[model samples]
Target: MIALNSIVSTFNPDDQQKFITYLQSKNKRRDTKNIQLFKFLIKEELSSKDICKQLYNVVQCNAYHALRKRLFQSIIDFIANNNLEDENSIDMQIIKYILASRTFLLQKNYDVAYKILDKAEKLADENSLFPILNEIYHTKIQYAPYYPKIELKDLINKQQENQKKHQLEDQLNIVYAKLTSLLNAISYKGEIIDFESELQIILNAHNIELQDSLSFKSLYQILAIANISALITTKYYQIENFVLKSYSILKQKKETEKQLFYQIQIVYLIANTLFRNKRFEKSLNYIQEMQELMLLKKGIYLKDFILKKTLLEALNLNYNNQQQKAIDLIEIAISNKHRDIEALLDLHLSLLMFYFQKEDFTVAKSVLSKFYHTDQWYIEKAGIDWVIKKNVAEILLYIEIREEDLLYSRLKSFRRRYKKYLTEIKQTRIFTFLNFAEQYYKNPEGFSTDITRNKIENAFTWTTVHKEDIFVMSSYAWLKSKIDKSKLYSTTLELIKKA
Candidate 1:
């Protein structure tokens, strides 16, 4: 049941209907039970034994298991064929052309063979389909001796040039893989990476040009890496210039229909980067551009980006003094039927932060409670950083409400889980900040606000205001507002304004 249901869950409702049609057309026997199993899987959550009993009117585990295996293979074949015929299958189409040309050439059909090669080469070149272009050139040169009107010297030169282009592609692929490793290190292993310096070294080692080597997909990956690095370091302002420049270069390229997905994500990254830098107006402008782009092609990728768009827009709106609008935006996006669990966790956490800032403790606690799953579950679904934030929020919310027992439990849990990691990463300031909160919660009358503020100012190594992360500042602001005897919401905004 789990095996078949996993594949079936990959299809959207429309695709499920299409799959039904697909099964009906491909059915070999008039009495096949594969379709019945598929429908049952989609519409119910019954166990394998229950499903088997329902389908067979008895416990026929052996027959049900065989049907499941067959259906799984059918889904795999369907997905493969569907992907090949998709509108975004330009590269696959070029490969198909190359294969057809080679077959025709073997049969001594020169007219059709050369014509197909020419067409494939043209499309491959236009799209910067370097890997496919490599195959195309190899085929052309392989048969250069057999075909007439073919300049062997010219074909060799073209192949060499193609090789050089794809060699650069190979280098970029290495850089991408290394960047992914570096990103995972920062995200989960609690390693402090100097991403900008590391990226510079990577580029130098690979001989990749800053401006020329990056194609659309490579640029998006680079931006994503930089964004994650910024997020982990709490220094978003450092990446603002680089992200903007990358997007400006991306804007000049003639974006193909297939590359639209990357373009929308690039735009979102730019908006998010700018928002982190407190450029709310510019961020909103880019978010508006992203919206216009999402409306293209009948909103095919809209659901894929709904949470991202809403999160960025809501953030911008929150900072722009439209707090209710921000809340409304997120609430609508949360109610969306999108099943991206990681993205949903992000939205829930951000909403929790918003309510906490508003000083609505009850609502904030409610929002925090929405993270009803275990810490281990969230760590798997999101990441260590998200789980850390969730734990901190829980502890702080309990502190606010003076729930001593819950606060102690959360404090113990957080220490056991993350203290060693944060300390190892040279992020002890987080511990210092949370400690102050706990101290204040335990003995507000005995807590020395002035001494705590002074200690925070001196003990914590602070970066320049412009380079500090907003969320980091927000966390600090809770202590600041308490020390200065001010409002948490305004203090958070003021810290961002200064930054």
Candidate 2:
């Protein structure tokens, strides 16, 4: 029994001679029966198919390569004789296991593959001969994927069924398409049809129940849906709710490769939503959480997440009254040049606002000069033109206030450029107020007419939708204070409370 166990244990034929010598010296394999058993064991390990034909040539009862080959063929024939289904047959299962395990190996998913192979070995033992079973088991121990305990067949089947029933892929495509259409509509650059019906379709596909027993794929789908919903509604509350729910589910699940992907997505969504809602401090917390998670999974590709986290950190610091630190971080991000252009542009815009608030024209001019030098400056032609006109006008107007030499000619030129882009600007209250503010500053005496006041009030109503930005609220309050001090004071207080 010990010899038999040793024979089964030799995984490679290179070690067969050592075992054969040990067995022969023990005098247990001098006879034909014992010699044949040894040969069979060697053949099973080597997977040789011509060993039996050469058995007659060997006089001594020792390890023979020919006998080893013959025994290997016999095992193969046995497996062939037994009908195994293509999908569920033990042979097919083993093949699929091998393929899947190889894929996981490439992905560095060793634990998952090892778990899978372990289960496969148990299943194989119930249906295969000892020689074949031993070979399969030893093969698994040698080469396994990460997380082998996760049975691929079961996971694939479950995910496939869920995907079909939920139409998750279809729903995601629809949502992406709807968002594209909505953005096009806002820009008047594409289809003008309403996307409400399509939005409904996407919302209907969200299965909150799946969150209770969330798989990695399900978590991914949920995150995608939540992000799309947030974009559609422009509401951070919905995003917060879904992200928190997804985070809870990920916490419950094992940290598999798929789960890691979901984790990254969830953290990104949370951070972005918090930033959009102007919950800067809360956003920073989520960014820190994401950074920790990424550190734990050291080799993961997280360039996008890192950039976004950096942006959030800078924005949060600025909001919390740490302007210098915020500016420093923004400069770091810019110097790295590793972030997306859009994010960089946003950072610069925020920095511009900060400088404007501080009345630091020298630094603001330097920052704006660098910004206009970039390729993105040309890309944001409309916004850049508006900012130049607006800022230049304010600077010239300030100089006039200080009783400096008034550059009326330059002011007129700036006003002309501002008016040139006025019609192209979106009808949002913020832009309208910006336009009115420019005009009011240009000629305060004539611009305080009732008609102008009514238009500013209407713009104020629209601006309230984005109450998260204190600058916008303060501007609105200033306009209202001009009309009615008591109403402006109360409204300003209310906005502060909401902030």
Candidate 3:
């Protein structure tokens, strides 16, 4: 779908309104088809053929295609200009500085040009933007013959050093791309591959070493790889040390405006890892840091990360015996349109689970309604795993609401869609969970039986306390709550207390 209507679909109602205003400013004529076409696309839920017919009411096919291309190009320009205006957006600022310097350098304004280049070089170096730094150096060296004040030999040596650093970063990028490909293969092709061994192979091929002077940009990719490994193994704690070290290094670098984006991401990763490993307080602490960073540069990255921060905060609060507060946090956040659609889906499902735990089935179903799109839509927006989770939640919700027919029908579809995927990932416990849920649906009283408990335990095994995933424990706690005839919230809290 490429997100339904390219980047336009990414905008929520608020963004749509903002884009209208932007388009108004960009429009040279009052009777323009661009706005009309945009309004039509957003207003109607029609297929391409129908849309084409409607669009061609007064225009020929060639004009329609030309108008479509112009509208698409306008959207691209709007997004580009909006990002360029971002506070402390270093790359754009550096480019602007370079352009300004080049303008003066053309007129033999050596003094002014050198000052601008100096500023650009400092900004690029701080952000470890080697390619941009090379550009700055190239301009300086290019004009060296014209300006005698600058040292040509010094500039050449500096560029040579930067080229080496850039090459190293390129190697890290190779490893990063390889890791992404490996993960995609595992999911799309259902290939069984060892995470560590595959990661090692890529690192070896790239001649990367942990002991090297890895820059912040390199560490970001490495942390991403660590996150991927943690996800595959369910051993988030294993990467804790490396992530913390990277964050510490970033902190020691003393906050560059250009590195703010990476800083926000690294802090979020730290907070997420802690939350996954059952360190709620510490996780919340880092989340506080992340939120603070987001507020910087006039909250330029806020839209990018608000949902993620809220999801983490809500999770930590919920675990700390503040379920209502957590629920309230997410409720307020979910009302707005954010760019992090993946995180939006997470919050939607998390809120649904919270309502289900509270026995607020009415509210739970309402939250479920917000996920009004198809599973294919969700799989593209989130992932296949998230889609599977949603399906399971739907089936369970149907069972809770006493919709027997819907529950059975959803079960049949869920199995048909995900049975092979579950087997590929060796996560067929989902089937076991559905089986027990079905039995419970048949006879609620049977949940208290020793045989039912035995069946549940046989299907769901645990290696140790405080190691299993929070969501896994959540589903188990729901079943346990039914078995013990206790409150779902309390059962969940007591169960995860060990983790």
Candidate 4:
């Protein structure tokens, strides 16, 4: 095990000085070797060998190990003696009391144990720590024989109630965890085939009901599950209704920091639903609403929330033919160092699409270089389905730069590698493109034909035909631009206007 002081030192630098001071004051040793050792562990980047030579002046391995164990115990004692009093610390405070009761009861201190247990019971009840409440009830029952004043009837009834509540809480947590796992799985694939039967099985097994007694945590899980279901089946309107109902539940209660965050999250969900449904204007309204809510709160995680909103806004702008504005927003979003690799990948891909559509081949090439540079390793790390979009982006780039040789090579390689992942309809589009590209590049005289025009029109329709496959970039517009011999932005603008 690591020395507790060493683990604590790795925390935020802002807390390091105060923690060090606490350790120094609690050292309580005349030799001061323990204090020196604690200071050495915290500040200096010294190895065990360095410590043996510099601090202890000993080469024996056992000496360093013994010193580390002692330091660990000292830090544990200091942590046990010190307590922080605050709202955030209330749970720990209750836990501390319960632990104290357990220790006192083990030593046969009945009166003291009962006093501590009573205090712990009140704290746990007030905080709705049902699990801890169950523990307290168990401790109460175990000590009931020693306390003559203990009412067996009342204690048993309360214990039964707490146990029931604890069971319900556990069930809800299990369902929530399962829903979260489901979300993660669907995020990569972007679809789940015929989940109706499976959904019924899960629902029946969990006995899930989102009603008045449901806690905010459980309600959030329900909303998440609903969102995932909608995304998998492309049922955006259903999710919108579910979110509205859940938002009503939230508004009926007192506002808190947690509620505020969830409120923003709900609005984001609504915005995304509208965006996916191609109601860009309405989506922008909700995006603005989310921004307004974000302005009222301050937190560390809020940046990620803001970035999400920005990305959605950029998507809205891009699809609405406002490429420059979308590009600007995407640049701003990617400027931040995001911890979410998927979000970063989305931003990079969006930027590539915008620059490519803008016909700024120079900037597009730069973005493509960065995409190619990181995407290979990043996709593996992030576990997202980026290959389809990545290959599509490469084809678009090669087509633009008139790199017929590279385009043919990449097309052949992509077909061989990712054939299984592509749907039949998607594979048909790829084959059509490859055949057209081969003719267009190898024989310029045969580039434009009645057959080519028909293929381009069909490809354009397939964008909506396979809209459910969001992982596919639907490269129909680029093909259309090539067929019509028009600017890519012009074609996109016309299409947006027609929509």
Say which candidate scores most in TM-score.
1
User: lDDT per residue, candidate 1, 1-99, as tens digits?
Assistant: 446766665566777787889999999799899889898888757878788998898876688888898899888888778766774588788888998
lDDT of 3 by residue, 1-499 (tens): 2233656655657668878898899888887778777887776576555666776764247776777788888888777776677534778889999999999999999999999999999988877889999999999999999898889999999999999889988887888888888877664445577878888887888788764335666777778888888887778877888788777777767466556787788888899999988889999999999989998865657777888899999989988889999999999998875657788889989899888888999999999988889887877777777788889889989999999888888899888878887886778888988888898889998678778777788877675666787778888887888788899899988987877
Backbone-clash count (model 3):
1
lDDT of 4 by residue, 1-499 (tens): 5754446443344334555676678667766566566667666577667776776687656766777787777666554554343223666777889899889988888889989989989877755567888888888888888788788778899999988766766776787677666655544543443454566667779776654334445556667667767755665655665677676776666544434566677778878877766678989998998888876633323555766888899989887767789999989778855556677777887788788888898888888777655434644554434556667777768877898798888888877765654452134556566566656666655655678787666654343432333222335556556667778777765665444
lDDT of each: 0.81, 0.54, 0.82, 0.68
TM-score of 1: 0.85
What local lDDT does model 3 show for residue 150? 89
Off by over 4 Å in 2: 1-174, 177-198, 201-221, 258-261, 373-426, 443-459, 462-497
State the local distance difference test value for candidate 2: 0.54
**Candidate 1's error at 49, in angstroms?**
3.1
In model 4, what lDDT does residue 356 have? 81
lDDT of 1: 0.81
* Decreasing TM-score order of the candidates: 1, 3, 4, 2
lDDT of 4 at 312: 92
At residue 2, give the lDDT of candidate 1.
Answer: 44
Better of 1 and 3 by TM-score: 1
Tens-place lDDT digits, model 2, residues 1-76: 1233332442234335544454455453355434465665544543223333345444443355444444444444
State in Å the error of residue 61, model 2: 67
Predicted structure 2, TM vs. truth = 0.52
